[model samples]
Structures are given as C-alpha cells and as structure tokens.
Target: MENAQTQLEINQCAGINLLAAKRKLVNVLEKIRHAYKSASPEFLTKLDVSQKAWEESLEADMEMKYPLEDKRLQYGSVYPMCASGFESRLVLARVEFLKEWLKGHQDGDICSGSIIHSYSIQRDCSNIGK
Candidate 1:
C-alpha cells in the first residue's frame, strides 16, 4: 500500500537523520574541545572527563529511546517508526544546542557567568517555559 511505503520511507529517513545529527553533535564537541585547548590544565582535564561521560549518556539515552526488548513488527506497527522520529528530533536538538552554545562562546557573551546564561537570559525568557 502507498501509506505503508510512505511510512517505511519516513522511518528509514528518520534513522538517517538521527545518525547525521549524532555525527554533527560529535563534530561540534570536537570543535569545542579544540577551542578550549588554551584553557587551564584543570579545566582541560575536567572537559575531557566530562566529554566521555557525556558520550556515555548520549548512548544510554538513545538505547532508552529504542530499547531492543520492545521490538515491534515493522510491517504493521507504527511504534518503531515513531521511535526513530523521536530519536531523530532528540539528536537534532543536541546538535542545535551545541551549535548555539558555540556561538555564544564566540560572541564573548559569557559575562553572565555561564556560557549559555547570557544568551538564554537575553532572549525572550517569557517564551521559554511555554
């Protein structure tokens, strides 16, 4: 059926998008690692350690979103396909967050104490929780 084919395509594309987003996130992290190379030794060590933990957390979160125990028949079920879409969105969010955080760093807007603080606070904070 046409609807089934479309759903399959969407599911496949979602997986590709998720992989691409994850790659982008890793690339951004690598850029950040390089950008902060001149920081103090303590900071560099902390960054390295945190980077490993962050990668682990990402893996864990992805596994949670697509657990193997809940496998659905791909032919008639939409659950697995929808899971891919959700994963794609989550990965894309991480990519955007890293990019925005990098932009904040480049803008020298860290006078607000934290890197993301200035950008988030300066934005229309009213729309944040909405």
Candidate 2:
C-alpha cells in the first residue's frame, strides 16, 4: 500500500503567474464592458497581435524610461498601451506565462494513490493481453 502511494504525490503547484491570471481576469472583465470586444469574428483573425504588441511596447518602455537625449525622431510610449484589443491579449499572455510555469513544475505533480491505481490498471491490462 505504501509503495503504491509513492508515485501519485508527484505533482504540486510550485508557483504561478499571478500577473498573467490578473491580466486574463481583467481581460474577461473588460470584455464585459464592450460585450465581448475581442470576440468578434473580425478580431479573432488578428490572433495574438495584441499580446505581442504589449510585450514589445513594454520592452521599449524599459529601454526608454531612462534619460533620453534631446527630442528624438522616434515616437515611443513610456509604458504598455492598453487598447480595446488588449483584453484578449492580456488573457492569452497570462495563460501562456502560467503554462510556462506549469511546464517547469509539471514533474512536481504526483501522488501515491494515482501511482498505485495506474499500476493496478496496467497490471489488469497486461493480464488481459496475456
């Protein structure tokens, strides 16, 4: 019994992108205001455009937040620009980030009961095969 319980205790929540979850939730809420702003068939075609743009803008802002020279020819924003399109982006970004985190911590998910049950099922299948 003890041995059987060993494998099932493998996976656990190591950490998560709270920021990403927050972004997703905000996205869901934002969509409520405009009645599914990004759900339109026209918007779905763009896919991840909003997420990419947000990350890029953030990276740029990080670069520019420092002291800049005289009026530059470049037009840049100091931070992420939230567009009506961003609702979906935020949700996706959050999910991706958390997925990344999960990928890393996936091995931590295990339990003894699950292991035992799996072994039991395998044994049954093997016997059936025989």
Candidate 3:
C-alpha cells in the first residue's frame, strides 16, 4: 500500500510539473511574439525557423532518451510514470533560457531581430532510471 501511494504521488508531481513547464514556455513564446512583431521579414523568418528547430531538437532528444513504451507489467519499467518528469525538465530548461533573456533586455522590450543566446540546464535523471 505504501509503495502504491508513493507511485501515485510521483505521478501527480510529474503531471503538475509538466503543466507548469508548458505554461512557462507558452508565456515566453508570447513575449517573443510581441517583441518581434515589427522585425524585418528576413529576420522574422530566421527567428521562426530557429524556434521550430529548437522545439524539434528537444522533442527528438526526448524521444531518443525515452522511447514511449509500456513495460510496467514485464521488467517493471517506470518510463510510463517518468515521461512527464523528463518532458517537464526539457520545457523548464527552455523556459529558464527565455526568462533570462527577458531579464537581460535593456529597454524592457526584446528588440526585433535580436538573437538571444540559448542556455540549457543540465538535469540528472538517474533517480528516474530506477
């Protein structure tokens, strides 16, 4: 019973963190949209392409690291429960990068065509591997 409760708690935590991370990313993207509205066509195109590339890269990385599979009844795979946590970590890293860029803006507005450096936060998933 205790182990079951613990598993339930882990699932819930993962769900909540995933939601929060997504929300943060959305907020950051909205900010960028507002900031880049008046940018040159070429610059805007580049920004759009880069944004898509970043998301695709993140998704590909996640899929590589955590291929969606249910082995819970067999070898006791916890991936089913841990997927949310891994996704949350990735989203949170992007969110943090955006937030830092916003903070560093000199005029309180992200300048059009400005390229902000991307930073990634390293996360240890060793605990989840168990």
RMSD for all candidates, in order, please.
8.6, 20.3, 10.9
Give the TM-scores of the predictions, in the order they appear: 0.57, 0.25, 0.63
For 1-130, candidate 3 gives per-residue lDDT tens digits of 2345667676776677788889889877766554544545675677579678989998898778765454355425455457777788888888877665344334335562264322111112112214
lDDT at 43, model 2:
41
Misplaced by over 4 Å in model 1 are: 1-4, 59-68, 73-76, 105-130
**Candidate 2: where is the Cα deviation over 4 Å?**
1-26, 29-39, 66-130
- Write model 1 residue lDDT over 34-101, tens digit each, in one string: 54444456756775686677668877886776667655753246665677667667667766766653
Better of 2 and 3 by TM-score: 3
Quick one: how many clashes does candidate 2 have? 16
Q: Which window of ten consecutive residues has the lowest lDDT sum in model 3?
A: 119-128
> What is the C-alpha lDDT profile of model 2 across 25-49, one tens digit per residue?
5554333323323235544334346
For each predicted model, how many residue pairs clash, with residues at least 3 apart or on different chains?
A: 0, 16, 0
Give the worst 10-residue stretch by lDDT in candidate 1.
Answer: 120-129
Superposed Cα deviation of residue 115, candidate 1 (Å): 4.9
